[model samples]
Target: MNVGIVAAGPVHDIPDLKKVNHIDYWIGVDEGANVLYESGIQADLLTGDFDSIEPNRLESIKQNTKAINQFSSIKDETDLELAFLEAIKLKPTTVYIYGATGGRLDHAWVNVQLLTMFAEKHLDAWMVNSQNEMTVKYPGKYELNKDLSYPYISFLPLSEVVNGLTLQGFRYTLEDQDINQGSSLTISNEWSEKKGTYFFNSGILLVIKSRD
Candidate 1:
């Protein structure tokens, strides 16, 4: 199953819902339920503390959604995190997160970190917004295709150091290189060919496909 999660971020940053393909289930986090409601999408589940949603909007969501998991504002987990846990319980094959970026910088950063949780479970997940699609990758070889919408591919180390980084069919190719966490060497590379391949021997990497 493919699960989609919507978090409370800037609504303008969300991609057009009509074009979002293959999402079998949707989970709305806090004010994000209002987003789904406004877009005429029925949320399969709504999970959040809901401090950000207005009373009427929350009531509307509660009426339309299949299930609701309302929580206290004093909970330990963030609303997005809670929604993510609920998503995993469904055993989705892939998870796509929207409204995860482009509002508060702190929230965006934390949402990026949440990708690692999906990775730990060996499930595929992506954090996508208007300009970028981000995912976490472990040591392995992978193929990437050129996307006209998101033309740049960047690899940033999530670990202290990523070892044996190599790239082929890229504008700026690397061979057996080690990149540090803060290194910008892998930023803004384009596909030299229609398809490119990359490999890393160790450490976690944050792969971001983006456009300006």
Candidate 2:
């Protein structure tokens, strides 16, 4: 099963929700509930402080969703994080997060960090928008299949350094290399074959597959 979580980020950055409506479960946060409501989509869980959402839309979401987790505006975590917490509880095989990027850089950064946290729990999660998809991988090997929709692949060290990093079947292959966080050593590489393989021994790495 897969769960899709949508937040209250800029609507222009979100991809077509209709394409992901088939997910087994859906989570909406703050004005993201409004997005689902307007799109005629139903969410399994609705969570947020509801500060950014209109009362009518919020009420509609509360009525349509299986449950609503209302939090105060003064809560510790962001509305999106709360919805993510609810989504992870379902233990979906994969979690797709939308409306999480392309607004405030701080919020986007935190949401990207959330992917690393979920990765630590062995959850397959990704933060996606119209033009980009962000994935965090722990210390392990990963296979990325070739996709024309997203041709450029970049790797960024999530920690101070990612050690023993190896890449195969890519335009720029690496063998037992160490990538530092601030280094742009592995960026804008394309798969030379049908698939590319990457493995790292320690530290988390952010794998971004994107295009203009």
Most accurate candidate by lDDT: 1
lDDT of each: 0.90, 0.87
Q: Lowest-scoring 10 consecutive residues by lDDT in candidate 1? A: 115-124
RMSD of each: 1.3, 1.2
Candidate 1 lDDT over residue span 1-212, tens digit each: 99999888899999987678799998988888888888889999999889988898688789999999999999788999988888888889989999999978998888898888887777789899988999998888988888888889999999999999999999999999999998899999999999999999999989999999
Tens digits of per-residue lDDT for model 2, 1-212: 89988898899999989876558888888888888887789878888888977677567678888888888999688888777777777778988898999889999998898886688778888888998988999999888889899999999998999999999999999999999989989999999999999999998899999998
Worst 10 residues of 2 by lDDT: 52-61
